[model samples]
Target: MLRVLSLLLVVQLCVAQQLEWPKQYTAKGQIILPYGDIVEPFTAYVDMSGKGRSRIDYYGGSAIVLNLGDEGQYGAMFKIVYETTQDFANVMTCFAVPGASGAPVTPQGVLPDISMYKYAADYMYNDVMSEIYISNNAEEEKNNNYTLLVRKDNKNPILFRFVGLDRLFGSHYDEYVIEYSDFETTVDATVFDYAKKFTCKGFPGPGLTLAMTENPMFEFVGAGEYEEKHRSYKVDSDFEEFKGHHSRQYDDEGEEAKRKTHFRHNHRYIHSMNRRDLPYKLRVNHLTDLADGEISRMRGYRHTPDSPRDTLYKPSISDVPEYYNWRLRGAVTPVKDQGICGSCWSFGTVGTLEGSQFIKNGMKNLKAFSEQSLMDCSWGYGNNGCDGGESERAYSWIMENGCIPTEESYGGGRYLMQDGFCNVNKSECGAKISMYMNTLPGNVTSLVMAIAERGPISVAIDASHKSFSFYSHGVYYEPACGNGADDLDHQVLAVGYGTLTPGDPDSEYWYIKNSWSTHWGNDGYVLMSRKNNNCGVATDASFAILN
Candidate 1:
């Protein structure tokens, strides 16, 4: 009984020792692993966790000890586990050494070089060691078989290399695998050095063999108090040599200049008024008279406000009209040019009225409306010639005083005086007028849906002169673009929405037809953001239902 108890005590002591935590140590200058060697060692600090017991963690990964020594050096070993049968296929290992102050040294060679070809031979580099290797696992693979050794002097800096596992194999899709094990050999310095080496065995299949040899001799370096040295190396090679295959010159200055130019041009045309002979107030009053009249015609309907400003409403994909098969042929027309005129309001109002007419009359022909008639004739609602106006007001004017053809009542012709009589062909302008009324104060989605279901609807937006230019993206609000909220003067037609791709829940983007020429974005049809503030679209109508 006494002998048995003693033996049990001995066994318990051995187990306890094996499970004990390794001592912490400061890293010395460098650690090295020679070529063709399987194992190397270095020193490192260990931190354990838990209430009573803990585990080692380095760079956020759990660490285990493979070897321990009091002399302050450590050893690590790596082996290839798998290789590919395909030619030119290989695998390789790489090491990431910590720079001074514990930052990682940038990996040296072009990542993913040829050594990554075969499966078994590729597993040679241990990133923790800042070294890599390529080697063959099979004798039949001897043609490409090779081995790499790495070592670091006590004061020397680390280096990197690519060891050919035989000759280069030219192919893609080759495979390789490797495994690495690390251990701490000594304790003293805060600095740790890691090293790795690789050996290759030939191709996979029968006749595969590996040579058995004694482990290579390794030296143990002692730890001592030394001043920390922080040094960095600069590449002597030309930067052009390192340029990626896809690299290109980016002209940031040119891009900025173009953007500025676009903004400037749009700003001037939209806001600035250049009066040739007529007074500024006269021009503005004429445009305002037309705009107010148009808006008054649509005042009978209930105007609803958008509830949630940010939420976007999209029409169901199935309900959207097909592009080629759409039946509202006359509703969609080419964008018109409002040349050097503050008459955007008139153009927008008339264009929308035309679409509405088509929807109400079931007519397939689109009749061009006379903007000059409204600019010159409308007294209370719109501004004068070449001056700004409101679109909704223009519609009200048209409803009250019916519009004639441009031939019968021509515009003051490009900075010229407004002729009271029609100068163009009056027969072409006699299209029947139509109107639609809104039942609720609808948001952008509801307005568009009403158009899609009922017919084209006339809507007002803040079209201050500043906002006349083309905008690629982003929301337009007052104060930011100098367009006041009350500047809701422009009129437009909401024709349809662009197609939505799968996964886009709110794909119902508004397709607004602008009075600006087709040279504008997407052929004068701006894609308005459907997410908020009704995308600046406000709907009001006079005719609730056409008789």
Candidate 2:
């Protein structure tokens, strides 16, 4: 109540004015996601070479390079991925935003970042601001000198609450809060080292692919040989915390030692990349210790490649809103965790059904459908319980096998997180579907239209990239993700679609709701780039029409 009243009081005495910023500078701070979730501490260098080229170095061993060129236009985050267990740890992964330049560059594409120290003197023309408060510290709520400003657009009054009004580029807006500190006007030329950004395997530049060559923590004489190449080093305590975050435990001490070595190499890879400006950002997460084979085991989508395309509905992409999300309309459900199971397809199917019901009516009639029933009972439809399955197949099972039971009806009041016996009453109807249909493969136009008219659509994509497994949020795009039928191995629900920058045609993205629990991603939701079919996201898209 006090926060609201304070905002109201400020508005009453609000003096609308334009905000100013620095043309180029250097600063250090942290990026915060919504609801006060912080990424890691960062040091940013902006406007080097007088070409708007800049970089934000995250403390946890990753950096973002922006405005370098065509490849660096949308910016990219440096990440580490192991192709195979034998592969040495390096920055083999570079998550990038490769697209045509748009009218407004979103935070995802903004270089040096607004938190990096204002890169430009001019601010957003549409932004109208009112003074909120002034503080000695940018982070302090009630202090002495630095000012706080509330910048808003004509539509959303609560668009952005920027701290550090004295320092034009403290932080910005709605979904994220980029905090700034330790300001310095002096620019460092060494900050924009080519090896840090362009050297990434996914970045389109010289020897980008050669980054696969690993600086192994130990020496490898043969394919599986392991020996010390460098002096013995003690494992960092923070690495143990990283392991604990993922609940990783090794069976044998040798394997444990090997993984620790791998973890150290991965850490060194990120730390070295942060020394200079990079086009992308990278960070350690649960999947950092696992190799490609181990990560692939977690992907569960099994749509057959070379199968005939099943085009069911092709709605015209006309008169549609540029941005639409089912969650805004109360159609999409809360993000759920799938635990350690590979039944992601079932969650996608049930979510789509639940959404369709909500869209047809409203949230008053919505119910949490059972994913366990599909895991246990839908095996005859080619769904391997708790293993892997296809979303279209689950839809087929529902079409012929009657209605799906609610989560409560299936168990008591919780999910049966693993494969279980068939306890579902086929005759009972908690959520009934009329039919399930697929849109044209790789067609973003039809997919967007169908989602806008229909409800959440069940979509699949190639989620094998190590970056994808530990995506911390932002517009997730990896040049390493393959775009083919054989590549789509994870099923998720597309609840909505929107652009980070309004009126920017090239900045649109799909709101993919994952079943990997709220602990991962943007609280279990991935804002994947749209239009390019980057990872075969729209290849096997399907949705349910509630009866």
RMSD of each: 26.0, 23.2
After superposing candidate 2 on the true structure, give the runs of residues whose Cα lies further than 4 Å from its correct spot: 1-235, 243-262, 265-282, 305-311, 413-417, 426-428, 503-505
TM-score of each: 0.37, 0.55
Q: Which candidate number maximizes TM-score?
A: 2
Local accuracy of candidate 2 as per-residue lDDT tens digits, 288-381: 6654465566678887653323448868556788788887778877888776668888888888888887867755577788888888888887
Candidate 1 minimal-lDDT segment of 10 residues: 208-217
Native-referenced Cα lDDT, model 2: 0.58
Residues 1-547 of candidate 1 have per-residue lDDT tens digits of 0011011111111111111222332222211222111112322343211111111122122111111122122212212221222242223322211123232111111012232322111112233232223333432322333222222212111222222232223221111111113334344233222212434333221110100000011101101111012110001011122222213233674443333323222222221121001011111111121222232332221112331121122333335342221124667556666644556556655665666555666666565557667666554643444545554455455555554343223443331323244343333443433333542343644555555664555555654432234343222222332122443545566665543333443433556676555645455566554444343564332121222
Best by lDDT: 2
lDDT for model 1 comes to 0.33
